[model samples]
Target: MPSKKIVKTSNAKKSQKQTKRDLKKRNKKITIKKDNFLKEKFLSSTANLLIKAVSIAANAAIVNREVGKRLNRRGKEALTIVSQLAVDVRNDVKQGVRAAKKIQAKKNGLKNSSKTRVRRLSA
Candidate 1:
């Protein structure tokens, strides 16, 4: 009597190929997830800032136009209030830009504090 061993070559090859494909798929999924997460965050933050800016500007304009017309004696006060609101909106826009720049720098593998400080100083 003789003992014989059998090796399943086709099965082994199939498994190897499947593992490689699975690895590639996993890496692709991770990259896509990271990209989508970053995109979503950027859009959400940008949308919030835009909404805030529009709201502030609309409020300031409405108050200046409506309140100024009714309170004839306080035209100067209304103008001053509108001016202040404009400044506030400007500051809000600047803050949004700063935040975006910081995120960009970080993504580029730059030191956030030093890069941000330099950028701000130059501005």
Candidate 2:
């Protein structure tokens, strides 16, 4: 006895072609969805980067302004201290001049009378 061979029919061929068409359509839909998702992700990331850059610039400007204010305050404080020192030195010089004139009058043998003369000269 001989074994009989199985053969593919027209109905099987038609079903295979239908399955291939279905698979192709499903792949196309998945690819389109993936592309849309990637586009959205890229746009969101770019927007975030722009916002961060603006924030950094604003922070830098604030820091620069603060530094300028600090420098100005320090400069004013230094000016005030120097001006006060100058006034103190001027007072000290005036007092020394008065003391030296009094010593000179006493050495000239004019103690009581020198008082009236010194006062007149100072005025």
Candidate 3:
């Protein structure tokens, strides 16, 4: 008769369970690392966007201020020109009134004598 050898299968079953637990732990670690990487990427992108938005706002403010300054300068120049024109018109109107008065006096036969004219010219 030949002797028979018996093998226990309990050890094989235990090893398979340990391998499954190891795989689960590895999966958890991978998921945690992925979450951290995603968070970092999102934060960096938002920071860059904020910086760009602030820069654009500052540029717009500068442009608006410059435009306002130019408008004010033009307005002042226009006002000066209008004031000068008004003064010239007023002087012309005064000269016309003086000429009309002189014509009316002449038509009424109120002429100055030659002696008075010579005196006026000398004065």
Task: State the C-alpha lDDT per candidate.
Answer: 0.92, 0.91, 0.90
Question: Residues 18-47, candidate 2, lDDT per residue (tens digit)?
Answer: 999999999999999899999999999999
Give the distance in Å from residue 5's predicted Cα in candidate 3 to where it truly belongs. Answer: 19
**Candidate No. with top TM-score:** 3
Best candidate according to lDDT: 1
Model 1 is weakest, by summed lDDT over 10 consecutive residues, at 105-114
Winner of 2 and 3 under lDDT: 2
The global Cα lDDT (0 to 1) of model 1 is: 0.92
Worst 10 residues of 2 by lDDT: 105-114
Between candidates 1 and 2, name the one with more favorable TM-score.
2
Tens digit of per-residue lDDT, candidate 1, span 35-82: 999999999999999999999999999999888787875777889999
Error of 1 at 82 (Å): 27
TM-score of candidate 3 to 2 decimals: 0.62
What stretches of model 2 exceed 4 Å from their correct place?
1-12, 90-123
Which residue pairs clash within candidate 1?
none
Rank order (by lDDT, best first)? 1, 2, 3
